[model samples]
Target: MKVRKPRLKAVDFFCGGGGMSYGMLEAGINVLAGIDYEPNCKQTYEHNITGAQFIKADVFELQEQELEDKLNLTKNDDNLILIGCSPCQFWSIINTDKTKSTKSANLLIEFTRFVKHFNPGYVVVENVPGVLRQKKESGLEDFIIWLKENDYKVHFEVHNVAEYGVPQSRKRFTLIANRVTDESIDLIKSVERKVTVRDVLGQVNGFPEIKDGHKDKTDFLHTVASISEVNKKRLKKVAKDGGDRLGFANDTELQLACFEGKDNSFKDTFGRLWWDKPSPTITTKFFSISNGRFVHPDEDRALSLREGATLQSFPKEYKFYGTSTSAIARLIGNAVPPQYAKCIGEAIINNHLNAV
Candidate 1:
């Protein structure tokens, strides 16, 4: 006689474009709904994560009953999983203006509201390492202390997603809190080998050469951003498979005023990626060569939208809906690298998500 194992279910908060939800679903967990304030994500989330409903509402404005009505969640269900991978721009270590992120800094505390109300069996959060670095100011410390006081056996650590099946060098902070049982709880384990850019890119991986700004007819998203005349000449001078700004350090004519005085701070800007290594972290500005090592190794253009999404470990079939390139780039850059999320989900399920 075969006894069916009950499936673990989850609700994803701040689920941008369904990345986390999609991964959990792939790992055999039922993600009931993904909630977010951005209406731009609704279409993509609804289209991709079939079984999950996309609830467009601000976390601050959202009520407990609304989730109850939408997800049909019962209070104190030891099998229920709550995911709060909030947008962490506020806590990100990037040198962007802190004033812009000031308003959203307290989002982690807001996620705690639902955690207290539902008392879910499992709680998961993935964010930038800066969150833990600035735990006191980011509300991470308070949240961890509260979860511990509430009987949650918590495990947290920062890990590189490249070691977990994602072909990029992305370091993220992960926290898993479980109250269902006190027996055991552990952080997600990594893969035996790393996946690198060479393993996924090039003609063998379906990324054949296309000119800068060339748009593939079959998939519009498989297109690169157009560069200016001056930038085109600069890219042509770069070597394949790991060319960098240093190549033009002595080229007085093509060098920009910013780097002329030997001030080479953001040297990665306009750099080509190494074919053999994992790519640098993909960010919201991945479409711009002026952002990071975003230029293609074999091509002269910055990474196409699809390529950026691929490095983020999103399924090639995953459809992202946005009006413009920047909009779509933001959607792809701000994802959890579905592969890493799947690892987290697998860790929980394999641990059996014990009963209360």
Candidate 2:
């Protein structure tokens, strides 16, 4: 008789829109639940991730015993995996006003509290590269020390998601720890080739050209933001196929005042993407031309919500719910690219579960 393989299960904290859980599920792991504080995420998470329970609460307020009881987790469960990708806005390089993020800066440390209580077999953390450089007050260094002292074998590094088949040039800091064995696990590996914008969006059809702020009549999420008449004309004059705003014919008069008189600071703004290259990192304001190189390579308008979700490796069928365009964009942009998360999940299965 054939023997059944032991089951691997996961619970994701800060599980925005279920991206990480979706990827783990795709990797054949049973994702039991997702926890987050955002009320808007509840519908999106439950709708997309079929079986996983969505718990809407702040991670800091929930006790470890409550979580363990909720998940039916026991100490040192060999198949248990805990994922925590705490809110990174405070630690990201792009966040200019660090002073306002004082509350968010401590969320990573808050995650460590659960780690101590549950003592799961495996733990995974994803965050911005700037997290490594945060001051001692943030508790990142201490977290690492604690993991080591607990007899967990830990490995961490900065990885480019494009290298793992995500169609974006996003770099993130990732750490994987396992207390079951002394052997270190490596999550980063080179793919055969990079996934590109053309590869993912080339054959997508039925995306009607719409101005900014107009939702597609046929598909609500396929809508683009409304563009001003002046910007519309500027987009038409853009060279196309990766052309940038700097290449505009009359920058001083047409461009924003910030770009007057050889002011090329935000050169990527109002720029078109290259078809063959991976897209720039997807952000909440990806639909606006004023934000980064968001213009389509061939089309005259910036990317729609559907296009942004596709670039983030969300399947066509994955549903998103939000109050407005910016809200939906926030859900999509803040998610872990499902493809990259799948790679990390697969590593854990192969390195630890299979080894057992």
Candidate 3:
């Protein structure tokens, strides 16, 4: 029997829906394990990303020793990469219900605990912009300091997803730490220019019109209340092709959402997309045209789950869970766009290969 070489294996923590892992896999890195507290993702993660193992475990409960045994990874496994994109609902601006807890913010400290135990050669983290506001005395900052103190060369940036080929304008704080590096490398610099929504969605065909309360053949469509009779009539009056509400609204029905007062609320809403331009960020509620400027810009209905996922840079074949509108939306919105992840993962693999 021949002894095989060690594979570049990664363990994804808080790996909701496997977005990051899929990106890494695209870059030729082997993702062996995905760990998340959400038990719902187990089947989808396993089914879609074949050969990958989904471990539905809370990172907080396990001792690092236990994880080491389960992963069959020892302290000497220097090729290991630990990725943690912990839930950011606490810090997300969209999650404005103040009652939501900040318990997830401390997950970085848990990440640090794993670092101390395994001392993996590489670590990656992604989170919302608000996570930076955490006090210096808090675990967030301490984790940053801990990386420096431990001699890992860290590269972090709040990068926009569009910059890395994800058609959506999602931005995230991405950090890559390498224990083997003595000098810092620019992760952000190597990434190319932004990709637009049109870039990703233009080629996908076979999507049919989805109306509120009606399911498509795939059962992935979302239902928004049918456009009000008045709005429907108004939509009809507007000139075809990406026309905004302004084209048809009279002064009486012109009242805008409080947030969009004075500004043109109809720019993306009830609007058609320009083939040449990029798309706005795809939120979980992307199925609802009223939620943002997600209306097909041409079609009367909003984008379907597949369209939304495509705009978010997920490959056409990716499958998401949940029957409710909110469940599928959360999965798509929360995922790290696979294309963006692949770009970063590719760079990491190249660097690692050169180093090894």
Score candidate 3 by lDDT: 0.71
lDDT for each residue of candidate 3 in 20-114, tens digit (9 for 90 to 100) = 98998988888988988888777667867667789878888978888888878878466888998888877776636646546776787787799
Number of backbone clashes in candidate 2: 5
TM-scores of all predicted structures: 0.96, 0.94, 0.86
Which of the two candidates, 1 or 3, achieves a greater TM-score against the reference? 1
Q: What residue pairs clash in candidate 2, if any at all? A: 212-225, 212-226, 212-227, 213-225, 213-226
- Candidate 1, after superposition: displacement of residue 246 in Å? 1.1
Kindly state the number of residue pairs that clash in model 3.
5
Off by over 4 Å in 3: 1-5, 135-138, 183-185, 188-193, 202-214, 219-250, 254-274
Write model 1 residue lDDT over 1-356, tens digit each, in one string.
55556789999999988889989998889989999988989888998898888888899999988788777789988778999999888888888887876867888989999999999989998999999999998899999999999999899999999888999999999999988777555645576778888888787988777888776645437877899999998888878889888777778888888887764678888899999888999999999999999999878999999899899988788888888889988989998899888988988886764443
Candidate 2 TM-score versus the reference: 0.94
The 0-to-1 C-alpha lDDT of every candidate, in the order given, reads 0.87, 0.85, 0.71
Candidate 2 structure quality by residue, lDDT tens digits, 2-69: 56657789999999998899999988889999999999999999998879999988887989989888
Scored against the true structure, residue 153 in model 2 reaches a CA lDDT of 89
Per-residue error for 270 in candidate 1, Å, reads 0.6
- The candidates, ranked best first by lDDT, are 1, 2, 3
Instruction: Report the number of the highest-TM-score candidate.
Output: 1
TM-score between candidate 1 and the true structure: 0.96
